[model samples]
Target: MYVLIPAYEPDMRMIALIESLKETNPQPGIIIVDDGSGACYEELFQTASRMGCIVLTHETNRGKGCALKTGFSYLKGIGASGEVVCADSDGQHLPKDIMRVGSCVEPDSRSMVLGGRRFSGKVPLRSRFGNSATRFVYARSTGVKIHDTQTGLRGYSTDMLDFLLEVPGERFEYEMNVLLTAAKYGYAIKEITIDTVYLNNNESSHFRPIADSASVYLPFLKFSGSSLISGAVDFVLVLLLHSLSSSLILAVWGVRCISALLNYTLNRNVVFFKESGIRHRTAFPRYALLAVLIACLNYLLLFLLYKKAGIPLPLAKILTEIPLFLLSYWSQKSFIFTLLNPNG
Candidate 1:
């Protein structure tokens, strides 16, 4: 196994961690990526190199995701055929915990093992709140219940390197993207409890909570935003067409044709577009078929609610959309844009 550390503006604590890893029973090769910490940190990198780590440097500062990909690419080029365990250089992850995560890596099993922290102690307020909010949103979006969505200590087998390199994100958001993609591709994620250490309330972390959180949550936000805008356009067009034609069928068809085109474009180009190999030729026909099905169902429900159930037309339209909204999201996600063969 190889130990990979992505360091930026690190301190002497990194040297101590390196020394501890050097003394392990079966010492693992250490690869540390200097994420453009600059010339001032050259001495620290030299010290780590003297301590027997293969230190790689970036000319300028790149994000943690880039640093990790650099390390993975180097490892792949060298044809390393074992597990690679990634740990932070801020002294939060213990050397022993890093080894523990590495020990859990099974050669044949493709599962990614994460060193999960319980957050039991006096955690920083931001750390606690961020983890809680991200966990809830992650579960709601992907139906995967991960305890720590932001854990930096993770173990990956050699086979996973290619896929990891393909996942999109540049900074803190990269880790979240990995988890989301893993869940989507049906990769089994196993979490092992590890020590939770926060020095100075995790002040060493360079994560900009607002900006990075927005990047991490952008996928879900984009999906919801697309839906909301499409819904608004549909509503306005429905009312306008109804007023002009005085026919529910004409209004529903007109609104759906306009809104469906808008929603499909946004979803295909922005929302579910990352690394999703689905071509427009394959996805558009399925999407058009789903649109027709949903349109018919929506109009039937609207007619029943408005004409037979004694409800106002506007209220009926609103009520009719709730179920179809969920159905549309599910069908588009599962049938229209899904990988034809996820395992392949």
Candidate 2:
């Protein structure tokens, strides 16, 4: 097994982590990517190299994701078959925890391990809030409840090298993206609790709250943004058509056709466009079929809510959309807009 640490302007804590690892029996090979943490930090990187880590350097500052890929590429080139455990340079991940995560790696298994931290102590406000919001969004988006979605300690088997190289993100979002689609690529996620250590309230971290948060939350934000846009149009049209025709069925169907068109266009070109095989001329027909089916389901739900539940027409329409929203998201991702290849 190998440990990959991506460092940018790192301090002594990183050396302490490396020193701790060197004391372990049957010590793992370590790979450190010096992410352009220039002159002053060369001593730290040099000390790491003297301790037998294969230190790779970047001439300029590439993001963490790129640094990780660089480390993965190095592993691939060297024909390394063991697991690669990724840890931060901030001294958060303990050597034992890293070993625990790395031990889950198997030659034939497609599972990734995460060292989840329970923020039980006095956690930093930004760190606590960020994890909470990200976990909520991740659960709502993927239906998977991951406790610590912002953890930097993770393990990956060598078999995932090709796919990891393909997943897109140049910064912190890259890790989240990997989790977002890990199951889609046939990988099961396993989590193990680890020590939560936030030194000086994680003050040494380089994560920019505004810019990096935007990158990390891009997937959820983009999809929701599209939904809000289409929903606004649907809201306006449903009210207008119901007022004009005085028939719920006509209003629902007419507005659905228009709103579905706009939603599909946005989702196809913007939302799931990165999914393999989606940039072709294939998804529209499948999408149209899904839309028609949804229209039928939408009308039925509206009818039940309005007629049987004694709900007002507008309220019923709103109630009906809640369930259908999940359905549409699932269908579009699972069938309509996804790549055809199961193993790809």
Candidate 3:
């Protein structure tokens, strides 16, 4: 196994972390991709080298994502291949936690293992909310109930490293993007809960609250935006069809069918462009089945609320719309979109 750490003028805690890693049994090969921490840190790299660690420098700061790519490529180039674990330089992650991640890595299986952080104890307020919000949105968009998507404490098989070359984003957002892309490729992702310790409350962290959060949450926003457009289209078409036909039920089904097709088309082609390989022929039938399932559920709820319960029609519509929209989004992102292109 190989351990890769991307450091940028790392503090003394990094040295302690490296030392701890060296003391572990079945000593793993370690690689530190220094993102241009200049002459001041030359001695630190040299010390690590004397301890038989591979020290690769980036001359200039290229961001964490770039440093990771360099390290993975280097690891592959040298034939020291197997599973690779990525740890943060800030020393928030424990070296022993690698064992938890290691236990989940199957020799022949292609999966990404992530260390789930337990936020039950003394965690900062912002950190807690940020992680929780992101997790909820991510679960809705990807259908993967991962506890922590932002943790750098993760393990990936060498074969999965191929994605390193294709992954975009240069900073914090890169890791989040990789998880999404990995899911798109049919890779199994599992989460293992571990201790959460903020070495310095991440005060010196490079992550920006609003700006970086936007990058990390981009996919969720895109999904929400797409759903909004599709919902509007669905409602408008339904109203138009109702006006065209005397039978309100006929208009409802017709509008739903048309809007579903439109939503699927836009989501597959635009939102998740690289993963739209469900063979147009096979996709429609499966999508139609899913659409019908949603319609039935929607109709049942609408009827129960508006007629039986005697709620105003508009209020009942709004009540039913919320749950319906959520169910449809999750089903589409996880099952429909995923099946459409199983081998992306």
Query: Where is model 1 poorest over a 10-residue stretch in terms of lDDT?
Result: 335-344
Q: Which residue segments of model 2 deviate by more than 4 Å?
A: 235-255, 276-280, 342-344
Estimate TM-scores for all models.
Answer: 0.87, 0.90, 0.80
Clash count in backbone of candidate 1: 0
Model 2 steric clash pairs = none
For the record, the alpha-carbon RMSD of candidate 1 to the native fold, in angstroms, is: 3.4
lDDT of 3: 0.77
Q: For residues 1-344, write the lDDT of model 1, one tens digit per residue.
A: 89999999999989988888888744799999999999999999999998789999999998999999999999999988888999999889998899999999988575899999999979998888888878976776666799999899999998888888877877888988889778877778999999999998899998776677887677668878999999899989999999999999899878888998999999988887864578888999999999889878987998899989999998897798776766776567656876756544
| Candidate 1 ranges beyond 4 A from true positions | 289-335, 338-344
Instruction: Identify the runs in model 3 with alpha carbons over 4 angstroms from their true place.
Output: 38-40, 163-169, 181-186, 233-270, 274-292, 307-312, 335-344
Listed per model in order, the count of residue pairs whose N, CA or C atoms clash below 3 Å is 0, 0, 1
When superposed on Cα atoms, how far off is each prediction in RMSD?
Answer: 3.4, 2.5, 3.5
Query: How do the residues 172-204 of candidate 2 rate in per-residue lDDT, one tens digit apiece?
Result: 878888887785556888889999998998999
Q: How good is model 2 by TM-score?
A: 0.90
State how far residue 306 of model 3 sits from its true place (Å): 3.7
Most TM-score-accurate candidate? 2
Give the candidates in order of TM-score, highest first: 2, 1, 3
lDDT against the true structure, per candidate, is: 0.87, 0.85, 0.77
Could you say which candidate leads in lDDT?
1
